[model samples]
Target: MFKNHPKGLAVLFFTEMWERFGFYTMIAIFVYYLQENFKWDQATVTNIYGIFMAGVYFTPILGGWIADNVLGYGKTIIFGAIVMGIGYAIMAIPTDNSYLVFAGLFVIAIGNGMFKANISVLVGNLYGHSEISLKDAGYNIFYMGINVGAFYAPFAAAGIKSFLMNNFGATLAQGYNAGFGIASIGMIFSLIIFTAFRKYYQQADYQSKKEVKVEKDVVLTKQQEKERIIALLTVFGIVIFFWMAFHQNGAALSLFARDYTHQFVGKFTYLLFDVVSLHAILFAIFGLAALLKKSNSSKIKSFGGIFTLAGLSLLIYKISSLPESGKISPEQFQAFNPMFIVLITPIIINYFSKLNKKGKEPSSPAKIGIGMLITAIAYVIMIIASLGLAPVYTLNGSTSAITVSPFYLIGTYFTLTIAELHLSPMGLSFVSKVAPPKMKGLLMGGWFGATATGNYLAGFVGRFYQEWELWQFFLILIVCAALASLMVVFTLKKLKSATS
Candidate 1:
């Protein structure tokens, strides 16, 4: 599966892995830190969350322009990483001042905007126009690297906070800062790896738009460029709803895990919350699949056997070491989405690859529509789970303190991860595949621009968490996702033809 790709893919993969580790680490603790540090209500916290996420995505427009026009993708990425590291350091200062927290988030947002879109553009730059199928597959591989970091981030946050608070008798605020400090170190590692591997991806790193060429400067006509941009903008506008719903993982969903969902678990059920165990399971599954395949390559089979044994050994080791029962953390529940991404991305890619071989693969837009429908299905689980739960606000104007099984949030995240694998990576691939070469960076940023809108909307929607019944709030998301899916279904043909 890793065969015959540009060496740059690996370079960018690991670079993104560490950067995302830091970002997700911060995200896993963001709202909790706010609530604990400042005593902000849900509305205020959600609004801030929405704005911060929006800024994180929105700044990419300028970041992409900077890469295209000034510093180049490589320099921009490095600069962004450094800025993010500084921002994380600022957040880790172990102070009680709230403005410093906002200031740190602002800096991180600026840096992420510079970093995110350009690296993705670099990924697309690695492939030729004729390699669209291979390009999509490559993005899936790259996306998995991102999730590997994300999968570890929550655990890292949990472990870091626990260690600081328990071992050093640190306060809660200090523990949160310690996690942010680890996030800062993650950025440093990202910078070192990406800088060291510069040779591998140097060819793709154009210092300016004049140097950019995909397939020997094949230029788009005015009409073609217009149509493609229109199509991409259409898709981007629709997926805003998807992000609005999916990002709830950080806002309403996190709160649900903290307040509305049961956190205690048995040894077996605790597997979901334990990153080490989940990581072992991923290795074992991959190994078992490889070993079962009728591969002619002895090397592949041997590698598979070794991985299988090692993974199972690790799992056994973990099982013996963990407590029989314990309370899981809310931040830990956020890891499920990334864990699913790591485990399932290959399957999704392989499935599409099979369909491609038979000339039956859905167009990117169609798959996106399917993903939106799935997003709706994901929330249906939440709606059901909320059926017996207390209303967020009641007739007496008092909120209930009821909780449900953690499985609801887990299941919701799992289902949403499926939607994300389809919508998000495919969205990035769509932008990379469809955008005109000259406008690649701008339009790529536009994708994030749309995400900025969606993420802001996520926090906006999160505000209603305190206003409506829990089920009603989720139902709003379901309606939005379903409507977005319908829009795609209606526009699928036009979208496909434009991209084609």
Candidate 2:
């Protein structure tokens, strides 16, 4: 866990934690902000959300290129952080014009393109050729840091917006920028964390001959490189559908939470939901303890255990004291996926570690294919959940919203989180492992570029929500994910060969 891995992992973990905090905070409330503030319709909001998300992922190609050939990963990450901070600041400004919103999104996208793929490249660079076996585990641990941030961001958004509305008597539209302001502050914290720990990252730098051997001099046959590249791109092609389905959390899923879910809760039901959250916290604490146990250093193990227990205790104490009679909002539901990630990541890691020991571990491509299939199952759950509910928006016309149990969404998110653990982090590991050393950043960017395509497709699918029944839309996603899974499985032998 914390032992044997590069110390740079801690720096990157905290850096990504704060970055994701800001990103997910903005995401949790973004579409609502657009709709309430600008009086936009659902189709327009979903489309805009899709396009903005696409841009956020799309810029990584250029960012990765700049890092690979120009500035290197470290400087690119720092510059990207600054640019993103500026973007967040722009969004935070209390302005009546919607132009600021789009402008802020544009800037954030540019900065993210620079930051996201390159940092992942840095993470991969942390482990050497001999340590390749640990790469997936390293990514799993790093990924948990991301979820820790995502898990709590919605709470920050909800609390900030609630404070502004209640304390200042501000309208929802008027007060939304306060949430954006909180996001900006998160970015500031990220920059501080990264700067303070910047020196550690140098330990993992391949360019620094004094610290690690440079693999850049290793040569491969052109045919070998070509085969690997084709294999990587094939996996990338299939995962496009996975992201298309997975990202519906922010777009179509957000709309469902707002319009279809039974959000209103009595004290008893609220307590029940709180119990679920408490279970998640307890699981995270135990997971952290298990990870700490793997540390070679006694001090790291003891310190991590105490720190984790204390932090979890504080979280539980805070949650227990929250008033329980109010309705849960759409934004609050955003916590479920990250919460599940925190709870389950260790389990997945341990399972894979066991498989590796037994010499039965699946290749990254197979895992990704399994993930695509699992994602299809998530949509299938959604389809079943929508069985009895009348159309919120039918082709004939809009109708009264039906309040289904929150459990439907909870279940949907649960399966999707599993799919993500199997695909997303593993996808990052695959890119890092398979790509040529000199071209790592560029190919990592390619992985995210595939994600951008999928997200754009998600928005395209979302735009059709108005035209079809709820179950029908879910059916479309299921088909896409299933088909992609089949494509990946079809090419499995080739993928394994190239990766080997």
Candidate 3:
């Protein structure tokens, strides 16, 4: 895979990987932290989580714009990295004040916003003249780097929490704070790596100039510009629902795991690595398969088949492990979605490559539509899962917190991961493909803006999981996503024409 790729790919990949390690490590415990430390209600915590995530995506628009017209990608990324590292370190400072935590989180969100879109734009620039041919594969490989960090973060955070709590005589709440500290350490490491490789970014500089030339050369009519903006806005409106449903992995679904799943393995596995070893194993198998496929197609195919079977078997095993009462820790299940991304991305990329060769590849719009629809289906699964549990608070006088099987949340994640494969990387590739050269950074930010919108609404939806029946909340997601899918499908021909 490295043979044909740009020399700068490794530098960017590792940078992104460590950044994600910090990001996911913080997210893995964010809601729990709020509950344990601040004594906020579930609804309030979810809303905060959603808002934070939204901010993370929203700021990228500004970052991308500045990078394209003013700052340049390298400088913007460096600045963002420093800000994020400082933010994470600040979050580690033990405090009873909610304002301080929120301030730290805000800084992190701003840094993320600046960092996220520009790096992708940089990656697209790396392909230069051969962008169309290489965009999909390049994004897929880049995505694997992201998951490599995401896959490990939870385990690292969980381990740190466990160690601090057990050995240092800290309470569970203090351990949670320690986990955030560990996440900050990951950010520091990311900064070190990025700084170390500053000299190697000449390729990124060369590619950016090419991008500027391409932007300057291409001209659009007033009518075309208007149409493009309109189309982008419409797409943005639809994608918000997709994100609202998909991002539940870090909020509602995670809560479900904490309330209902069984995380214990045998003594041996637990001793060597905490029970989070299961997540590490799943990620490893998937990541290895994806990276190794370049060497042997047959081996790749064999690994793909085995991975599917293994995932299915693991799901079964997790379901079987559930106690008679259905409450489990929510964080344990959060790993599954990233694990799914690691497993499915290579297969999906290869499948599309084959389709492209056959002249049968789906349009980007079609893929987005399929993703929205799949997200709708995932919500439907969650709705069904919610039906099994009674409401903690009822309209009538009587109420109870009923235990439901963990399978519902697991099944939802399973379906949502499929949807993510269809949308996330393709969305990134689409921005690189359709965006005007001068506007690459800005448009990339726009894509993240859409995500920001979705992420903000995700908080609202997560709050619903607290007040409404879980089924009702999920049902709302299903309807929202279904409508979004339909809207995209309706405009497919127009979008295809615009891109062509």
Per-model lDDT: 0.88, 0.83, 0.75
TM-score computed on alpha carbons, candidate 2: 0.91
**Estimated TM-score for each candidate:** 0.96, 0.91, 0.86
Q: Give the best candidate by lDDT.
A: 1
The digit string of per-residue lDDT tens for model 3 on 234-300 reads: 6667788889888888887777665533454443323213243365356446645654566667767
Per-residue alpha-carbon lDDT of candidate 1 for residues 1-500, written as tens digits (9 for 90 to 100) = 56788998998999999999999999999898887888777789999999999999999999999988888898999999999999999999976788888899999999998899999999988888888888889998999989989888999999989998999999887788888999999999999999999998888888647775747234779999899999999998999999999999999898888777766788878876787788788889988888888953788888888889988999999888889986889899878888899889989988999999999998888889999999999999999999988766552422346678888888899899999988888889889878877777888999999999999999998999879888899999999999999999999988998767
Which model, 2 or 3, shows the larger TM-score?
Answer: 2
RMSD of each: 1.9, 3.6, 4.9
Candidate 2: segments with Cα more than 4 A from true spot:
206-218, 266-280, 283-324, 394-401
Candidate 2 C-alpha lDDT tens digits along 1-500: 56778898988988999999999999999988988887788889889988988998889988888888888788888899999989988988877787877899999999999999988988888887656558898898899999988987888888888888989998896567888888888888998998888888875544322222455223557888898899889988999999999999998888888777787776545543453455545645774775466644676666657656765776667567767665888888788888889888988998999999999988888999999999999999899888877665552333336678778899999999999999999999988878876678788999999999998888888987776888999999999999999998789999988766
Estimate the overall C-alpha local distance difference test score of candidate 3: 0.75
Question: How badly does each model clash, as a count of residue pairs?
Answer: 0, 0, 13
RMSD of candidate 3 to true structure, Å? 4.9
Question: Model 1 clash pairs?
Answer: none
A best-first ranking of the candidates according to their lDDT comes to 1, 2, 3
Residue 474's lDDT in candidate 3: 80
Pick by lDDT: 1 or 3, better one: 1
- Find the 10 residues in a row with the least total lDDT in model 1: 392-401
